[model samples]
Target: MSQKFPEVQGGGSLIIAWQVKEKNVLVVGGGERGIQVAAGRILHALNADARVTVVCPSSGLNDEVAFRIAEKQVSHIDRNFEPQDLDAADMVLCAVDDPEASTRVWKLCKERRIPANIADVPSECDFYFGSVHRDGPLQVMVSTNGNGPKMASIIRKKIAGTLPDNTGAAIENVGLLRKKLREVAPDLKDGAKRMKWMSRVCESWSLEDLVEMNEADMSQLLDYYKSGEVPSLKAIRDTQ
Candidate 1:
């Protein structure tokens, strides 16, 4: 088991939020079960603005995979995996039922130093797609390294349940407010001041209040930041 999962030597893998935008992702296979895995990876890549190429027999494709190809959302190869497929691939996702084929893909990916995930074969995977909860720009991922996937999912749900439903909107509004604040105080020397002011604002506002914050409220907040003052709740509401 330790040989199968090298990370066991050091607790677990280090989790990170990878940026795959504009990168090429090679997806292989679309068998009955493979279809689900392929479709998921395809959608996730597209969501990250990554270029996707699906390599699978036409008959093996599921409705979702076929629909994506029909809509020109991704390029399709309509054939089995080939060594050349990894030429420009930043990553690979193999979901074929044939263990040999999956292993071959993993070997090629390793040769090229490209990360790969072979469905249902955690031993060959360079990465794991753990349970994730996404809310606008906020994403929380729960990983159990390759063990207890269902447990990871349950924990993810409990974590998500603890957050307010509108938490995403609040975060987005705060991000926008942060941009406006930067514009109002763009001097490099004021970085610490800006951070402190933003921290104060975040701590003082409720989730609902942050969600309802408008351009006027942001402008008033900037005024307070500029004057080195922290606005009271009443002062913030007066702007509305």
Candidate 2:
């Protein structure tokens, strides 16, 4: 609360937001921590439709996540890092526990004006990654804003349990309803209306409740979810 940058107040977690949406992220580390961070990078990138490139030496992980990154078409540099490694990066994460190396990466990023997060050293980070829970594309990132990572993580787990497993399935059916509504509802083209509909659907029909419904039921559900007017049929015909 006192600082401009988001950081875990206890100093273990740094809290900051990096726009991983459609932006490339470079995670530099090869240990278990590095692998953990890389997975988040991959999921966030997949959700945001972004690209990911992982940079690390081959010494750390006994597992195959490093291999998976290559197989997944995520860009990878399978060796030690150099200062030039950061120039083209949109966001940087120094996940190694080694202070000297992370410091080197952090300094270079700062000098080059790139955003970087230093793991194991919250005070050194520019941003913090929080615990998250997702329902289909309904993703929520929980943070103490860096004040309390444990608290943030606890809240995320609690929220996760409340979210039904079939929430993701219901989301897909709603996606179809939205596509059809976009065609029929011209007056509802307002951005606010559209966002409100999404929020309303999330609240009313609710992802948890819709899991039992089939496709036809979902479409009908969305219809009743929208305003009763349903726009003019002439509006639908005009484009044709």
Writing each residue's lDDT as its tens digit, candidate 1 over 1-240 gives 566864535768979888999999999985688888889888888978899999998999999999999999999998888999899899998888888889999998898999999988999998998888989988899999889889999999999999998888999999998899888888999999999988988998888888888887787777778777878656877766
Candidate 2 residues 7-125, lDDT tens each? 65453434344456767777787566666765665556556666777677656643455555657757777787787777678888766656788888888888988887777677777
Give the TM-score comparing model 2 with the true structure, all chains together.
Answer: 0.69
Q: TM-score of every model?
A: 0.91, 0.69
Top candidate (lDDT)? 1
- Model 1 residue runs over 4 Å out of place are 1-9
Clashing pairs in 2: 6-15, 7-15, 8-146, 16-128
How does model 2 fare in lDDT? 0.67
